[model samples]
Target: MNKPYVIIHTHTSIDGNLDIMDLQAFEEASRQYQELSLDPEKQQFEIQGYLNGKTTTEDNITHYKRPELDENAAPVPEGDYVADPDAPMYYLAMDTRGELAFEENTFGYGGVPSHIVVALTERVSNAYKDFLRKKKISYIIAGKEQIDYDVMLDKFYNLFHIKRMMVGGGGTLNWSIVQNGLVDEVSVILAPIANADPDGHRFFVAKDPYSSIEETSFQLKSVQELEHDTLWIRYSVKKK
Candidate 1:
């Protein structure tokens, strides 16, 4: 059996908002990716901290928050930020499960696992099927009518050669993984800014609260201080 490693790399605010980014937040995420990346050259470029602690915008990224690439396949003409080497295979955009009306997309680089598996239900719409097909994205249906936990894990290890999976959540997907006990660890990067809406969406449970971990605990791994007033802290989840 392959040793599966799970980690959640995320940025949150003091009030638990993970929506938008300021300068420090972006840099910290970039640094984390740089550290986990397999490519050495890309790691060097990302660690320079040039674009550290800045807001992510259209000028810096594409339609999604992905960095805009030039025709030559370079991340940008300005700085040395290189795109993740394994982007094509690993980055997954998770659409709304079953409902084609409001699908979600998640874009990440090489730090993600080998399999970019989207957890979904079986009753997905035709529009979604076409969309995933056109995008050349593979998906897994969990619960009923799709990929369940054991089956998905088997596929991940056997087919995709995935020993580790870093799940960057969009609430529902996060809830799914946590509820299923698929996730083993979580790393939350808390920012200084507070959310404008007190009752707005949070990093974890908002309405349907699940059981908190009983035996699961975490240990501080490391903390990196950036130019901005932000702090990057990593925690290792001590499993039961």
Candidate 2:
């Protein structure tokens, strides 16, 4: 199946810990991401939407509300229900459990894109469906309970013509994408500090929860130092 080009843009510490927790807020690190990503290489790749996991979306996104679904709610089409991805910027939130609430079609967050796409699963209740319709926010059913990242990504390409996509958020989302061979590239912006959380998360979450750490391969594309003693590195995922 055809898939959109995917890039996971994220930041961490020199020790490779991504969960800054109480040490730094997401917006602050996100600002750092924006600054470091100004590299000509990343800038050249056009992205239609930036994808985020449910937790990160809820934490970083605000100013949206849940309104009652309309009695005259419109039905979304079936059979690989598609839409064009190239028109406007989108913040695709992977909310498989139908737990998110939004007021407008777009998120009110600053800096990042405005348009929002709430990715859902079949298990989402009809009431929630109505809520989304009432809000006029776009969504796609990816699976029964959990999201099928590959299928949804292809849907993004087919419906929206989104050729390039960037996924930035938590380790679970990034690890899932890489584990599924969905990511073509990885961009890491490392803050040169020792803010590692003893019980914090890292860049990539392993596919197996109990498995020991193993070596992964990547071809270094570019490396540089940005302002604030940060190290910006880009690497192409290499299949072994």
Q: What lDDT does candidate 1 reach at residue 90?
A: 48
RMSD of 1: 11.0
Q: Please report, as a residue range, the 10-residue window in candidate 2 with the lowest summed lDDT.
A: 78-87
Model 1, 65-175: lDDT tens digits are: 432222233221221111232333344333334332212233334443332244455555444544443344455543455435565555444454456655555444454
**Which portions of model 1 show Cα errors greater than 4 Å?**
1-3, 21-88, 93-117, 125-131, 145-147, 206-217, 238-240
TM-score of 2: 0.80
17: Cα error in model 2, Å = 2.4
Q: On residues 1-240, what C-alpha lDDT tens digit does candidate 2 reach at each position?
A: 668889999888766687654554443555668644333344545776778876687666642344454445565454332233444667778876666766567754334445677778888766677666556677788777678876798777777667788887687788877767778899988776556567676777764541234577999999986665666789988897
Backbone N/Cα/C clashes per model: 7, 8
Model 2: residues with Cα > 4 Å off, grouped in runs = 20-30, 36-44, 62-86, 108-112, 207-214
What is the alpha-carbon lDDT of model 2 when measured against the actual structure?
A: 0.69
TM-score of each: 0.56, 0.80
